[model samples]
Target: MTAIRTLLVANRGEIARRVFRTASAMGIRTVAVHSDPDAHAPHVLDADRAVSLGGSTPAESYLDAAKILDAARRAGADAVHPGYGFLAENAGFAAACAAAGLVFVGPSPESIAAMGRKDRAKEIARKAGVPVLPDAPVTGDDPDGWAVAGADVGFPLLVKATAGGGGKGMRLVTGPDGLAEAITGARREAAGAFGDAAVFLERHLGFARHVEVQVFGDVHGGAVHLGERECSVQRRHQKVLEESPSPAVTPELRERMGATAVALVRELGYVGAGTVEFLLDEDGDFFFLEMNTRLQVEHPVTEEVYGLDLVRMQLRVAAGEPLGLDRAPEPRGHAIEVRLYAEDPANGYLPAPGPLHHYAHPTHPGVRFEDGVAAPGEVSPFYDPMLAKVVAHAPTRAEAAAMLAGALDATEVHGPVTNRAMLAALLRDPDFLAGETRTDFLDRHPVLLAPPPPTPEVVHLGAAVAVTAARRRAADPVTSLAPPGFRLLPGSAPATARWTPIGGEPADVGYRLGAAFGDTALTVTVGGTTTELGLRDLGPDGVRVVHDGVAVPCIVRVHPDGSVWVNDPAAQSGWRPEPRLPDPELSAAAAGPVAEVPGTVAAVLVAAGDQVTAGQKLVVLEAMKMEHPATAAADGVVAAVHVEPGQYVEAHTVLVTLTTGPTA
Candidate 1:
């Protein structure tokens, strides 16, 4: 076996950090490649050596095979770990590494090419005696041909991009009339995401459970399976939560599925880490979906149960060592993992990228936090909105679910909007608790999507306490020149503050300072109720406000418009202080439609002087690998277009103006 002395991770974020941790433990020097925006990223700082890929976008940096190879050569790296996504499953990248005499820590280029396309992979599985769902032949650019093929595949089918995975380039067509549009949209998404627009039709199983078997193979011809992970909890066909030891999978079925995965790996002569995905129906019959010829994003749940580091196994296998496993070990316990993303669940789950001012993770037994960005860092609009993955393990499925739920409840992310509350609610959902999760879980239970907002009293009180504390600090004469041991004396006079919640009426708060609890301790009265509040300064821009023994950590930023943006675990709200002055420009622009999330304008459907109807699509913005259409508010003439195609805009930026002519 050839030993790899130095390895270069050809990706970024948590996956890169994960590979580096394993490589360092194995006494291998690790190299990191980063883009311009990720110059100070945690993964770069953790590596022994780092090289700049230069550009910010994926094509210019992570996905550029030439640049990655150059970085590897400069760092003297003997091997490259793709670490999933970007170029992880790219056959050309694997071939390039092989040609450069550098070990690619994955299956061979031939295996990747064989399994990269869903249509081809299904054919391979069918040939190997694995059951596969009936699928239409790959469609060409002709729209009529696509329509005909889709009809034969049947209605309620899925238009799937052959070249890539993830929900991108995938569309669910319930009828024949929508086939052409679905095909076009799928192709556009596929071409943008994977550089390929080839698509095919597949029989869509509306309520099937998404289960996949994790398989490992070595160059020595040894292969094994690490059981299965249930990934039925999804949104927009993308997995949100994953768990190992699926409730639907029994010992007999697990063995059968495991055997099937191993057989396919052996047939393909695959090496290194790979995942064999399958769709399990209610009758317990499973059909092969496709094989992901690389590590999965949800691999942690499998690793947690098996008590093994899959990355370490990948390294050993890439070095040409045997798996050393005659039979797969039985998973000891249960594990659950949820992806934490910077998206607003209340607003159609739109991507919400901003600075993470007060990021805190839960510290509990059997809890793991794999994060990409540290607090005080910006979640850039250029990449996926996923910030971290939180996983929990326990001796039982119920316990694991509860533990993960609690971990999410305790975790505080106070900057951009996140799906923390929604994920926690899903874990506690009755159907989820009963293991009735399916691919349409979210669609069936829309209530779990938008979590209830915090109590009005909590918001008002929290804001009052925060504002009062800030004012108190500023009012003190010694605040700017205080000594290390200096403490502010309690004041007798009550402090009064008035502020209006974003969508609520103005509130008047009266509070008096008491003994210090770091910053200020006060009893605030609002809306005929008084509650004790303890405010502690976390940093220049953050505070920990405690009420009734529960702490609410928040980051409070005051904009130039005299508005306070309070980001807290309870919720996010903007408060305007008393005597709120309106800007005429902003007030006039408010009549038009504004973007709900930060993204680049993909298309401006309406130009100045165009007549539009209410709810008509006016602009399409792309963010976080999804497109959001901003529609006109009322029937009117387009007075102006604020943003053009390819222009990046922030959340709530007005993109179009309209003249309603006597009505709006």
Candidate 2:
């Protein structure tokens, strides 16, 4: 162990900011490392000293062990803290830091190497008499041994990548027929993702809640376990919501699970922060999953409930200080965290990365937000989709639920579509509130209700407001110089404007600028209807005017290229057929030949002369972990094939051409 006074945070974004806050509290000087794009990031501004890692892509910056180590050395940082993701669990990075005489504020390289492999973790769990899923290893050089091992586990087994998490490179097999194929596919994916193809088998539990205990180990040979977190709500094996004092955990179960987790960490000499995950069955029977050898994404909830600064504890433990385990442990209250992601829940939750147009968080007590980026546009596709983690703590679970719901409702993130509403729904749903949920909660019940279609009246009101704002801009030059309108403007509109009139007749009407009546603030005039509007904001972006006490967002936009767009947000939408089919002349890129869309090539189906029809799946492109099929423009023979099965192509890179027309 080393006495580290200056720490180098070998990561970027919010996690880095989080680590620095704790390090700074300990009177430790911090060194921040950043990539080219993140040079001006908040984390950089928070550090005592800053260094650039060079390059924007993760591989060129964060994962480059040499660059990170050099940064630590140059910045005079005696220790490096690999915060959570990127290279946190990389045993190689840990060893290199140790070999360079720098303290790695995490577990030792040997411990990481042992538990980082999921198979080895299972073995450790089994030897410690921890309850593990009934399964057998299928790895062997002898064919007879392979058959015997396969028979022992039988069908409906899972092939899990030994070096993977996040459900990547894991396959579910329901029968022996698909066992080999599934394993092969799992291995390929695992190799591509973790750079290791080794996999093992396990029993696939159809229904279970994911609960994990946080445990800490000390050099003085003492280990203690914290309470468990209910992580039953997950999407694609990634935890979306987490809460402590799980409804499933009684006093007896909590004690039993906590003891088991502590025993494993002590027996394995696991140090620093780690999570021991277990699949809890309905009958209160729990089995060991695997240990995550680094900080977890959902650690904030635990911190809130335990009243502990986990990051600070990590630093103290790594510094060879006693963990202060002289006293007993206690966990009180309830805490919950919801991951705010830059994704569209309506569009199959596809990643929606772009510049944020506007953002504002709900301000209230008992609410904490750990964010990676802030307003003024900072969403990127090259990183994880999570934008922030909003956490709330309360004396009771009900209060916690209400707190989260109110916070999300008050949150204003107008830049992109998010799962805030969905997460809020989960917190308020009866099933979730009672803590009775499974991993398939979202899949079994899609809470995505298409908002009711925008009322034609609102559209008409929007048209009127657009016309008013446009005329206002032309009428007053001083107000035009102001921002769109005002920051979340508050007022009472003179009248509620309607786009098309009632009785199918168009009309125009306005109220006195300074007139008020009881039961209503501003007067509204329609062709045949008069109403008032509780104005929220009146800006260049249009008016967010509420009528009949209902809020309606009106988008008033004057395009830079001289186009006007005024519309209401659709509550829901169904897939509609395109009225205009793609034309050959309208192919993308237009550089002699159209190019392939941005994605990883799943397959190239056509050759130089194979005939194909329109809408045929010519090539499958996988982006953000979803398969998108690119089809042919029209019926034609493939003139030339350019892409391979595993080749990565960017947007507008020519893939194939049609023989029927000159490669337009």
Candidate 3:
């Protein structure tokens, strides 16, 4: 009840670091609780004191409520702030924190448990006079339920997990025939994701915009909405881009939504920062979705627009202070935020979890970074693949979007293939620029996901450069024969040997050295659409090859096997240029380990000494809360099985090694 002197940030990634920053600024001590793998995470460095929670995985670390409370107690923290995800909305965790006499910087336990179930929240929404979509009757035992509006309404419908936020228990059912599969699938996934398979169906509002009102409540009985954020731009039900004051939300609609949000908070007696989410359909009709009983990931956009720090508000509310205002404050300028993930967008958005090689963020006024971790290596795979959240604010939405685009271009991340280019493309897209976005924005639009093709000029220039390099190779002073030519006379013009560009290829011009053109007999090879080599200056001993008027440094070396090693001359001073050679082992293609997505490991069958058939299941990796088996690459004996039961391995982590069978 007294001033929150020390708060234990029981979270990770950008959110933890974000909360720690606010706590430090408020002259409050912060305790960062981390797992073994996250000992080196940025939040640990930013906190006043740090505590080791436990193992690497979520259940072993952040999800362990008892352990987190103990860590808070050990760190001398008087309060526990569950940032957004993990156990943030867990009613049991909240109750436990209250029982431990530590401030839980969120809603009351009852509100959490009420909204914790999809069916219960729907009933509550219906009673609150909020438009609630009709669904199947709720059963005591949480089974993944199913509901549908009609096939005529849409091509796809959403089946959501009842217990928690995330794409874990969510699935898009394409047709009515797929409802059963989708239900069972959603149930299985929800079980793994939230320890409950209970799910409910909503008429899939495909073109719906996710506009949520940020409602804050203090224990002293004050609650209000801080406006809305557009979180519709997402992939696989995961939000990527969010902005405040959704383009579609009018002042009237905002008031209605805000009033509805406050009504729900009052009905449930909810406390702290919570988001009442609604689906603003294409017809401008908004439907009550659900309530998140914690601070949101995209809260910064709201903070920027509303000109109030939600985290600081949470800290103040936890310390038993009022909202400090009688009502929701007027919102300010526009703000946009993009969640930069550590994944390869081109390769089906595969998680590229590894060392961050080069990380640089552009320093500018309007742009702000709520980053948790950094470069120089080791972005742990045993966690969310989100790298950072970059935000930009401006007087106008268009300017904010422009600032975001420029920031993305200026910032360089060489560690992994990120969605940086795709995000930039989305920000500039005419549809997005017009503010017509939907939940299916990413799914329906393939153009935003694809990298922009190279311009025609660049293509032509690259081809020309390659051809020029080829001619330079043939015209070098160390060169010998020009297509093994025979010279007739010394005074006569050297017999010009003609080379063909071939079909669709650049022109290859071959000519012996003229007396004035060069000092040594030169043979110029041309390929592609342009001349390969432009004879710049040829001296008695050395000749400088010029391509595109740029002095390029090229190194030539002969290996022991007489293979040529060509290297770029302008390699960085401290680093030696690596010799490029064909990796003999990588020449042939083969199916490697099974990709580990966001799922559970249902079973791991083969042991280290087990012989397996080509189609046999070696390991099962469950994701989105479903199980998938990783079969053998070919008929072979398991030389080494790297994973065991319940061991979560990432995609391409070499789960098992195989040796050829006896048939060989």
Give the candidate number with the greatest TM-score: 1
Per-model tally of clashing residue pairs: 0, 9, 13
Report residue 118 deviation for candidate 3 (angstroms). Answer: 2.2
What tens digits encode model 2's per-residue C-alpha lDDT throughout 471-584? 566578665664333322356454433233211233455642321332113344655566656545555555555666676666554322223334454321111111134455
Candidate 1: lDDT over CA atoms? 0.83
Off by over 4 Å in 3: 137-155, 453-593, 596-600, 603-645, 650-664
User: Model 3 over residues 205-245: C-alpha lDDT tens digits?
Assistant: 66678889989888888888898999999876889999988
For every candidate, C-alpha RMSD to the true structure in Å: 4.8, 7.5, 9.0
Question: Could you give candidate 1's per-residue lDDT for residues 517-604 as a string of tens digits?
Answer: 4555667777788877776663446677776777777767665455566666545555666755655766787657888778778778
TM-score of 1: 0.87
Selected candidate, larger TM-score, 1 vs 3:
1
The residue pairs found clashing in candidate 2 are 450-572, 451-571, 451-572, 460-498, 460-499, 461-499, 484-540, 485-539, 524-531
TM-score for each model = 0.87, 0.79, 0.76
TM-score of candidate 2 versus the correct structure, residues matched by position:
0.79
Model 2 scores worst on lDDT over the 10 consecutive residues at 570-579
Error of 3 at 53 (Å): 1.5
Whole-model Cα lDDT of every candidate shown, in order:
0.83, 0.72, 0.70
Q: Pick the candidate with the highest lDDT.
A: 1
Worst 10 residues of 1 by lDDT: 480-489
What lDDT does candidate 2 reach at residue 268? 82
